[model samples]
Target: MINDLPIRKIIHVDMDAFYASVAQMDNPDLKGKPIAVGGGGTRGVVSAASYEARKFGVKSAMSGRLAIKLCPELIFVKTDFERYTEISKRIRNIFFDYTELVEPLSLDEAYLDVTENKLGFPSASLIAEEIRQRIFREVGLTASAGISINKFIAKVACDYNKPNGQHTVNPEDVLQFLADLDIRKFYGVGKVTAEKMYLKGIFTGKDLKAKSLDYLEDHFGKSGSYYYHVVRGIHNSEVRPNRIRKSLAAERTFNENLSSEIFMLEKLEHIAEEVSKRLHKNNVSGKTITLKIKYSDFTLQTRSKTLAYFVRDKAIILETAKDLLYQNTLNNSVRLLGISMSNLNTKPQKTEPLKENTVSVQLQFKF
Candidate 1:
C-alpha cells in the first residue's frame, strides 16, 4: 500500500511500423514503398506492413492474398523476429536508465511510470524526448512518445500524433480531450460494442457520462463499471517491472490456400524461430509446444506436446513444432499456420549445480 501520492507522470512509447520500419531500415530500397514482412507464398500471412501499404487498404492479419489484391505492388518479405527481438531489448535497456517502472505491452509498445525518476527530472515530456532520441540513435529506429498523467491518456496521446511524434496530456485537459472523443475510442470498446453504444445514442464521453452506472451495467455487464470510471478519467493500474509472460505464440493467416506441405513447413519454421527467440530473450523455457492450423473454410485445429524438461533452444522448438504438424495431417488445405510455446518455466536459473544426479535448484523466477 502506497500513500502520499505525488504528481503522477506516465509515458507511452510506440514504434511506428515497428516490424516494417526495421525491415526498411535494413533495406534502403524498401523505404517509402509498400512493403510487408511475413509469409510470401499465396498462403502467407502478413506479420507487419508499412504505412505506405496501409494507404492501399493493406493491413496486418488480412490474409496475404487479400493484402496483395488491395495493393497489387505490395512487397512481401520474410519476418526477421531475431532482429526485432534484439532491438526491443536495446530499447528496454534505454528505458531502465531513467526509470525501472516499465511495462512492455509488446516488442513495439510500452508504458513508463516516471513519477519518481532517478534523474530527478520534473517533466515527463523531457524524459520522453530523450528516450526517443536514444532509440533513433542507438537502435536506428524512430519512436513516438506520449506523456500524460496516466497510461490510458498517454496511450491515446501517442496515437494522436504518430510516425515519430510526441504529445502530452495533462490532468487538467483530460476531460476536454475525452469529451469529444468517440465512445469507440475508449480502450475497451470494440467495433461490436461501439455499434451497440451508437444505437443507444452514446456518441461521446459526455453522452456516456450521462448514463447511470446501473444503466451501463445492465448493458455491458462488468465492463460497464470500467467504462464509467474511464469516462471520468479514473484509472488505477500500476506500472509493474519485469512482468512474467505465461505464454508466447505467433500465428499467420495466409492470403491464399496452401496445399504444399513443404511451404507450410517453411512458415512454421519462421514462427517457431520467433517464438524461440522470445523465450530465450526472456530467459524462459517452455515444456509444451502447440501447433495450430486453420483451413480455407475457417475451421481450426490445435495439437500440443509436453516435454520432460523446459527448453528454449530454437532447433528443439522447431523440431517439436514440426512433429506436431506432421501428427495432425491437414484434411483441408491450410490457410493459416501457427507455432506457440506455453507452460513455461516462469523462473529460469542461470547456473545448475552438479551436486546430485537430480541437480540442485535455484529460484530464478521473479514475480
Candidate 2:
C-alpha cells in the first residue's frame, strides 16, 4: 500500500528564532546578544527568545521573571506585530514564486507543496536550499526547511536541523526515519499523551506500530486512529492553502493573582472585548465561547458553552463569558485569564459536539 501511494514533495519552512532574529536583523546592535521579545515584568511571558538567551534556558511562553533568573543579561523588547506581519508577507511572496500551494501556519512558518513547481526545479532539496538562501538574501533572516513526502514528516524533519538549516527524508527512508523517532517528538503527542503512551509501553514509532489499531483506538479515542496511521508513514492530510481561522482569542497574566470574583469579572470583560474586536476584524462570528483560567500554581482549567446563534458583539461575548465563569467555583487564585470564540461561520458544519474538558488541539505543524 505504501508503494502504491504517489510520493509528494512537501517542504516545511520555519524561521530560526523568528521574532528574536528579526529584532537582531533590523538592529545590528542586538546581534549576538541574549534578547527576548515580550514584556519584562514578572507576570509577562516571553514570546520569543534569541538563540543566545536559549543557551541559558530561556524559552517562549516562560515567565519573564524566570527567564531573567536564567539569563540575567536577557534583553526584553516589546512585540511589533505590524513589522512581523509585513515580513511574513514578503516571505510568502518568495514561496509563491515556487508553488501556489503554500499553507502558512503562522507569521514565521509554512508548508509548501512543490511536487510541481513553477521554477521547474526537479530536486526538492535544491528548491528548499534556494528558498532558504533567498529568504536570507532578501528578508535578511535565516530559515530552515524540511523536505519529505508528507506534511507530518516534513514538519518533523524541519526541527531536526533548525536555525538556518535544512533536512530531507526521501520516500524510501520515511519508514526507517519514523521507526527511530521518539514518541514525544511525534506530532499531536503532548506531554500528557506522551506520558500515557510511555506507561502503555509505547516509547517510539516502532513501539507504536506494534499496537493494534483496535487497541490504539480503545486507548486514545479518535486521536488513536491518527497515531496508528502516522506511525506507519501514512499521513494523507494535504497542504490546505488559505485555511479559515477557526478561532480568535485574547489572554493575559496578571502581575498579581486575582482572588476576587469582581476582579475576575472585570478582567473577563476586557478579554471579551478584545476577542470581539478580533472577530469583527476577521468578519466572523462564533457560536461557542470558552473561558480559560490558569491558577497561581499553574494548573489550568477551561469552561465552554455553545450558544444557539453566532455572536460577535462585545456585550454578548462578555455576558456569555461571565456565565461560564460564575458557574465554576474559583478554587484557586487565578494568575491568568483568557477567552476564545470558536464554531465560527454562519453556515455551521454538522459535527460531533466537543467533549467536555477537551480543548481543540491544532495539529503540531508549526514549531
Candidate 3:
C-alpha cells in the first residue's frame, strides 16, 4: 500500500501565457487581441501566444510565418527577458511569504510545498486562490494553480484550468484522479513515449497500472518502474528547495541553413558569450562544453569536450565550443547552433534554458 507515503500539500503555480500576458499587461492596446510574444520577423519562431492566438492554432515553438498564416492578425512582440525576470522576482516574493520551500520550475511556473506553511493555513486550495489574487493585484497578471497531494499531480492539475483558474485534488481522491488521466497526460510521458505506450496497449493510467512491474521493466527499463509506481499514486520525490543546475546553454536558429564552418564561427562566438555570462551570473563554471548541431533535415548531433578544470570565460567557452565544432565533419546544412557547459563546479539553481532541445524555424537567441 502507498499508505506509508506522506500526504504533502503541494501547489503548482503557472502564469497563464506569461510572456504574452506580460506584454498585454504593459501595453493596454494588445489586450484581448491575438498577440504573440517573440517571433517577429519572417524567420522568427513564437515563444508565447495569447489565448486569442491559441484559439487560431497559434502556439509557442511554432514558426512566426506559420503562426501568421494560422492567425492573419497575430501580432509579434520581442521577448524582453529582463522585464520578465523583474516581474518574476516579484511573483517569487509572494511565494516566499507563503513558504520558503518554493521550487521555481521556470520564470512562469513553480512548485510550493505548503503542507506546513508560514501562514499556518490548513487549506491549500484557499492559499492558491489568495496567491493568484495577489499576483493579479500586484503584478497585473493572472495565475492558474493546481493543488494536490504531490508535485506531479499538482503540476498536471495546474494545467486543467487554463488562464486565471485553479484545481485541487484531495488526498483521498488522488487515486481516482490519477486513474482517470490519459497516458499522455502523465507528466514525464512525451510524444514518443506516449506512442510507445499506445503500441503496448497502454492507453490510460489504469491500463498502465494493469501491467506488472516486471512487465513494465521488461519493456521501458528504469522508466518502466517509474510509470509503474506513479500510476499507483507513489511518487516520493520531495520538493527540493535547492535544485542544482545541470547545464547552462545558449543557442541560435538561423534564418537560412548554413553549410560552412567559416560562417558558423561568428555565431558560435556569440552563443559562447551568452552561455559564459549565465555561468558567471550563477557564480559557477563547468568543464564540459558541448556543441549541439541541428541539421536542416531535423536530425540532431552533439559533440562534447571535457577540460581538466572548470571554466566560464567567454573566450574559453568560445574556444572550446569551436574545438568541438571543428572536431566533427559538417554532416549537412546546419540550421541551428548551440553551446552548453555541464559538470558544474558549484551546486546552482533550477531553470536554465535548454535552447538546443527545440528545432523551431525561427527560434532566434536574442536577449
Candidate 4:
C-alpha cells in the first residue's frame, strides 16, 4: 500500500440531472413526468433528459426523433442557460460557505477540497452530508457527493449513490476500491479507449493495474500514463477555484506562402492535430471551431462555426476546420494558418498527479 496517504479531504458534488431537474422545479407541471430539455425537432439533439425520461432510454445527445420513439409522451422543453447559470451560482455560493478551494467542472458538478474547512470539521463525509442537506433546503434541488482522499477517487465514488445520495471511501480502502472497479467506470477511459482496453484483455482496474507503464504507453501513447496512474488511485491534482481556459489554439506559419487548397488542407490537418492533443491533455471539449487565415500582405480573416455539442476528437476537429477552410476562397496566399477552439465544456476534470511529503489526517471520521 502507498505510505502516509495524503491528508487532503476531497469531495465531488454533482447535481442530479441538473437541467431536467431545474426544468421540473421551475415548471411544476413537468414534475414526475418524462421530459427532455432541448432536441425538440427532427434534427435536434437532447441536451438533458429527466430521470423519468432516462428510464425509457432517452439521454442527453440522443436524437429528438429517437427520444420520442422511445417515449412517445416525452415532453420537450427549451434550454434556459440563464436560469441554469442562476441556479449554478446559488449552488456555488453554498460551496464557498465551507471552502474556497472549489473547482467547477461544469454547471452541474464541482470538486471541493475541504481539508481545512470553515466549519472546523475533520470528517469530509459529514461535511458532504451537511452540504447536500443544505442544497436541498436552500436551493430546492438534490445533490450527490463522494468524499475521499483525492479528487479522482472522490469523483468515482460520488457516482456510486447517485440522485440525492453519497458515498465515502476512507484512505485505507482506496486501493482495493480501485482494484474492484470496472475499467469502463474509470474516469476518462471513454468509449474508444475502453474498446481498445477490452481488446487488450484489460477489462477492470485489476487488469489495467497489471499492465506495465511501457505497455500502456505503447498502446495509448499520450494517454497511457493517465491509465497507468489512475488505476492505482494516484491522482493528486488540487482544486483551483479559478482554473479555466477561455480558448485553446494551435497555429503554424509557413516557410513559404502557398495558394493551393491541397496545401492549406495539409497545414490545417497538422494544426488540428495539435489542437486535439491540447484538448485531450486539458480534458476539455469545445463546440466552437475558428479558422484564422493570415494573408501574405498581413491582412487577417477568420471564419467560425459553433456546433450544438462539444467535440474533442481530432477527426471531428479536423473536419470542422476543413469546412471553415472551404467556406471562403483564399483572398491571397496564406502566410499563417491557425485553428482555435472556444466555448469549451468547462474545467479540466482529470490531470496527472504531483508529489508531496507525508501528511496526516485525523483518524476519526463521522460517517
Candidate 5:
C-alpha cells in the first residue's frame, strides 16, 4: 500500500514550554520549580507554562492573575523575542540542511517535508530522531516530534507525547485515529466551532462523516467542505518553503452606495484603524499605504504612497489613507473602500532578561 499510494513523509516538531525551558536551561537554579513565561505583572498573560505549573491547572493564554491564584509558587518571566528568534533561525537552518521544505507555524513549531530529503533515510522517524537530537545537542533545548504521511495527522501526532518524545501515525492508522478522536481535537475546530459541532451531535469523525455534505454546508457553511476532507484523512495542504505576503489589507463593501464625503471618510478611518491594529500586533510597520475604491458601477481604482519611515499608528494610517483617497477622483458613487499597508521595516530586536534562580526545580527522575 505504501508503494501504491502517493505517500509523502512529513514531520511536525514542537519545542516543550519553549520560553520557560530556555530560561531554565540558562539558569541552573530554576531547574525543578514551577515556572511560566510572559507575565509577572497584574495585566500580563502567561505565554508558556512548565509541566509543573500545568499540573496546578495553569496554562498558556490564562491571565497571570489567574495563574497565580491556581499556583501561588508560579514564577513568571517577560518574553525575550530576540532569544527565541535566534533559536528559531538556528533550528530552521538545521532543517534546511536536510531539506528546503520547512514550514514554520511559529517560532516554536514547524512541519518538515522529508519525503525526498538530502539524508536519504528509509524512514522519516529516523530523520525525526536526528532532528530532535540535533536540537538538544546544538541548541540546548528539548523538542518533540511527530512523523506521518501528511500535515494534518502529523500535527496531531506530535502532541501525543510530552517533552522530548516522538510519535508516528502510519497511513493505515490515520483513519482510525481521526474517527475516534474528539471533534475538538480536529484541526481548525476551535472552542466555538467545537461547541457548535457538539450541539449538532457531531462528537467524533464518524459522527461528522455521517452527515451529508449539503447538510454540513447548510449548517456550517464552507467549513463543512473542509471537515469532509479532514475526516477522510485527505488533506492536500502543501508545505510552503517560503511564504511571502505581498499585501495585507482589510476592506468593507456596503450594500448601498453613498455620496456623502464625511461618511466615506469615517468608513475609511475604521478600516485603517483595523489595519493599524493588526500591523502593530504582528510587530511589523509598513512604509507603503494603499487605498482601494469601488464605484457603484463596479469601477475600481487604487492609489498608494511610499513613506520615508515605517508606521503602524492609527492616526498615521488614517492620515495617509485619507490623503491617498483624496488624490483619486470620486467621480461615481462609492460602494467599497479598502486600506492596505506594505513594505515592512526591520524587526525589533528582543532581549531576554537573565535572572538568578533562588529556588531550584529538579526533575525527580534526573536528566
Candidate 6:
C-alpha cells in the first residue's frame, strides 16, 4: 500500500525556541542564560522558554508563577512580536527562494514542498540543510528541518533532531520508522488519547497497526480512521501552499479587567476595528461573527451569529459583536475581548505577498 503512494519531498522547518532565541540573538548578554518571553507576574504565562530554562521543566503556556517556581533564576522578557514578525518574514523569504510551495504553520514554523524547487535541488536533505544553514547565517537563529514524503512524517521527523538539526525519512524506511515510534508521539494523539491507547494495549505505531479499522473506529470514533491509515504510512494529504484563510480574528488582553458592559462594548469596538482592518487587508469577508470573552478568572465564553450575507464593514462586525455581547449576561468581569469572522467568502490573491499581521485561526488537518 505504501509503495503505491506518490513520493514527494516535504520539509517541515521549525525555529528553535523562536521568541527566546530571537531575544538572545539580539542581546548578546542573554546568550546561554535561562530566559522566557513573557511577563513574570502572577497572572502572566510564559510564551516561550529558552532551552536553558527547559532543563528546569519550564515550558510555553505554563504560568509565569509556576515557571518561576520551577526555575527561580529564570529571566522573563516581554514579548516583542514586531521583532519576531520581521524575522519571520526574512526566514520566509529564504524559503521562497527555494520553493513557492510553502505552507506557513505559524510565525516560526512552515511546511515546504521542495519536490520541484526553484533551485532545482534533487535532494530534499540538501535543501533542508541549506535552508537551516541559510536561516542561521541570514537570520541569526537555528531551525530544525524534517524531510519526508508527506507533511505528517515530515512534521514529526522535524522534532527528532531539535534546536539546530535536520532529519530525513526515506520512502522505504517510513513503515519501520513509524512502527518504532511511541503512540504518544503520533500527530493529534494527545495525553488523553495516548492513555486510551495504552488501556487498549496499543503503545506504538506497530501496536496500533495490529487493530482493525473497524475496531479503531469503534474505539476512537471518527478519528480512528485517521489513525488507522496514518499508522500504516498511508497519509496522502497534500502540502497546500495556497491554503485559504478560514477565519480572521483579533484579540486583546486588557491590563485591567472591566466589569461594566459599556467598557466591554468599547473594547469590542476596538477589537472589531482591528479585525475589520485585517479582513479588508486580506480582501476577504465572512458571514459568521464570533465574540470571545475571557473573564477576569480566565473562564472563556464565545457567542456567534451568522448573517445571510458576508460583510467586511467594521460597523457590521461591531454591531454583531455588540449584539452577542448584550445577549450574554455579564457573569463576571472580562479580562480579554476578541472578535473573529468565519465562513469566509473570498479567496486569497496569489499575487499578493503574505502579510505578517494576519492571524489564521483554522487548524490544518494533515490527513
Q: How big is the positional error of residue 347 in model 6, measured in Å on the Cα after superposition?
A: 4.3
CA lDDT, every model vs. true structure: 0.83, 0.89, 0.88, 0.89, 0.82, 0.88
The residue pairs that clash in candidate 1, if any, are 43-254, 64-255, 65-255, 347-365
What's the residue-level lDDT of 72 in candidate 5? 98
Q: Please report the TM-score between candidate 5 and the true structure.
A: 0.70
Clashes of 3: 0
Q: Give the TM-score of candidate 4.
A: 0.73
Off by over 4 Å in 1: 1-4, 250-293, 301-334, 337-367
lDDT for 169 in candidate 3 is 74
lDDT per residue as tens, model 4, 97-170: 99999999999999999988998997899899999999999999999999988888899999999989999988
**What is candidate 6's lDDT per residue for 1-367, written digit by digit as tens?**
1132236789999999999999999999999999999957777889999999999999998989999999999999989999999999999999999999999988999999988889888889998999999999988999999998788899999889897998888866778899999998899999999999999999999999899999999999999998988877766666677788899999987878899988888888889999999999999889999999999888999999999998999999999999999996988999889999999996655564322211112122121
Q: Model 4: clashing residue pairs?
A: none
Candidate 5 residue pairs that clash: 31-361, 32-361, 32-362, 33-361
- Candidate 3: residue 363 Cα off by (Å): 49
TM-score of each: 0.77, 0.89, 0.92, 0.73, 0.70, 0.90
Q: How many residue pairs clash in each candidate?
A: 4, 0, 0, 0, 4, 0
Write down the RMSD of all candidates, one decimal each. 10.0, 6.3, 8.7, 10.9, 13.8, 6.9
Q: Which stretches of candidate 3 lie over 4 Å from their true place?
A: 1-5, 347-367
After superposition, candidate 2 runs with Cα above 4 Å error: 2-5, 346-367
Task: In angstroms, give how far residue 299 of model 2 lies from its true place.
Answer: 3.3
**In lDDT terms, how accurate is model 1?**
0.83
Model 1 residue 244 lDDT score: 66
Candidate 6 stretches with Cα past 4 Å from truth are 1-5, 347-367
